[model samples]
Target: ADLQEATVLTATAEFLDDHTVRVSDNSGQETLIADRIFINTGATPIWPNIDGLLASKHVYSSTDLLVKDKQLKELVILGSGPIGLEFASMYAQFGSHVTIIDKSSKILGHSEPEIAEQAKNDLEEDGVSFLLESNLTGVNDTLNGVTLTI
Candidate 1:
């Protein structure tokens, strides 16, 4: 395998110049000068500026939901995009009561209207609900779960 000969280091790299980088890890730091350099910047969740959202312990991002071990009996997802629909479908099939709220009038705005309608129908058959043309005004974290003011 070609990857066997390549050096692999897991560290934060700071680009110093066009060809030099300062890499740091828990052990120490090292300066590397290479003809070619690659950087893999992973994804980070973008939270809305809605009130009580950031402070709520019940709120979970897609990444956070991945590591969460708790079983969610009810779920309210914000958005009807590809990722949002994916979560809604998966969770609904998993026996969770999933509801998707979006500002748009329809789901899968980028797709054909007929296709989108079919997808919505399929999701509905799976026990998923949709709140279209709705806006999330605020959030409230109760003893049971987080509540959304739409």
Candidate 2:
């Protein structure tokens, strides 16, 4: 295979020059300088610039939720994009009360209306709630859980 001759590294990379890069993992025990590099732009969670969101200890990114061991009783998601809807469906199946709040009036805005409606109905049948055309103004960490000001 083409990758048989490749020296692959799973680490953070810093471009030192046009053809050179320095790569190291969190341990900092091993570092490598490579003249040739192939970039794989993987998905990363983005924290929106919403008030009290970054400061709240009760909030977790999608990445954090993926590795989380504790089961949640209730969940609130901020988007209706593919990734968000996928999470909503998954969490709802897990018996978590899932709510998705989006600024848009409809889910799957780019897809056909019929298909979108069916998807929404399917999610709703599985006990997922949608708050359309709503903006989350802030997040507050409560004694019980998190509260969103919409």
Candidate 3:
């Protein structure tokens, strides 16, 4: 609520010194300098370097999936991390055929082994398919759906 009432400045910030920084917008406005500043940058999805992946119209990031309100029939997720697993579970519950592919042998490679295994089992029981120890080599956009090469 407090943030909504505050005046927001959309600008690029550049550090002038150790304690000062300059903020300027695209419009030829005068740059404002602040003695103290806090940086709050958000995160973006890092796509892998794969042949014809970026050019495909069917490809979507985790962020993209979140904001999309349309229902999907088939979804082929390329990663088995938290984002991929969560989306798989959500989409499966919504009646979408979800397929998750990962290069690692196990799902949730960064989490505890037992926990990851349990989660993977739960997702599988919910009708989400897992393709482990596989790498996505290519992606092709089809008229009906996107085809992924694993």
Candidate 4:
């Protein structure tokens, strides 16, 4: 808990040289010597050539829906890629009504057809809904709490 608190403190640094630094915070300023700085912000998600889709609430990047809120009984999910489907499975198992939309006619495209079919059936048995071969025109239906128009 102490480390977590320390990690949240904001500090300003003035570099004296490659190995020397100055730090300022609420307590005041100080100079110190350091060997290196490491940055590990992780991967970036890139979407190429899709217009106006970013503004649609229906278009949730892999990150947004990761934290499942059980109180939300209905979920309209976009995409059937690993990331999207993984969340779908997790949420459905937790008892949310999950609807997944995939542009391709067959989901899990790279997998064998039978494997994909079986997996789809399994998820269906678990009460997950899918709208395959559907192009997301927008998100406008309020009837189901959420819906992706094709």
lDDT of 2 by residue, 11-40 (tens): 887777766676778767344555543343
Candidate 2: how large is its RMSD?
11.7
lDDT of each: 0.83, 0.81, 0.80, 0.66
Residue pairs of candidate 3 with colliding backbone atoms:
none
Q: How would you encode candidate 3's per-residue C-alpha lDDT over 1-150 as one tens digit per residue?
A: 011233578777777786766677778544455553434343568799999899999998888998989989889888877777878977888788999999999987878898788888888998899889999999998888777787
- In model 4, which runs have C-alpha deviations exceeding 4 angstroms? 1-53, 56-59, 68-70, 140-147
Question: 29-67, model 1: which lDDT tens digit per residue?
Answer: 999998855343435566888898888888889877767
Estimated TM-score for each candidate: 0.68, 0.69, 0.69, 0.57
Residue 64's lDDT within candidate 1 is 79
Order the numbered candidates by lDDT, best leading.
Answer: 1, 2, 3, 4
Ranking by TM-score: 3, 2, 1, 4
Evaluated at residue 48, the lDDT of candidate 4 is 35
Candidate 3, TM-score vs. the true structure?
Answer: 0.69
lDDT agreement of model 2 with the native: 0.81
Model 4, span 1-150: residue lDDT tens: 112221433588777888887789999987777675322232334453444566545455556565534345777666666566666776777777998888899777877788678778877987899999887665543544444456
Q: How accurate locally is residue 33 in candidate 4, as Cα lDDT from 0 to 100?
A: 72
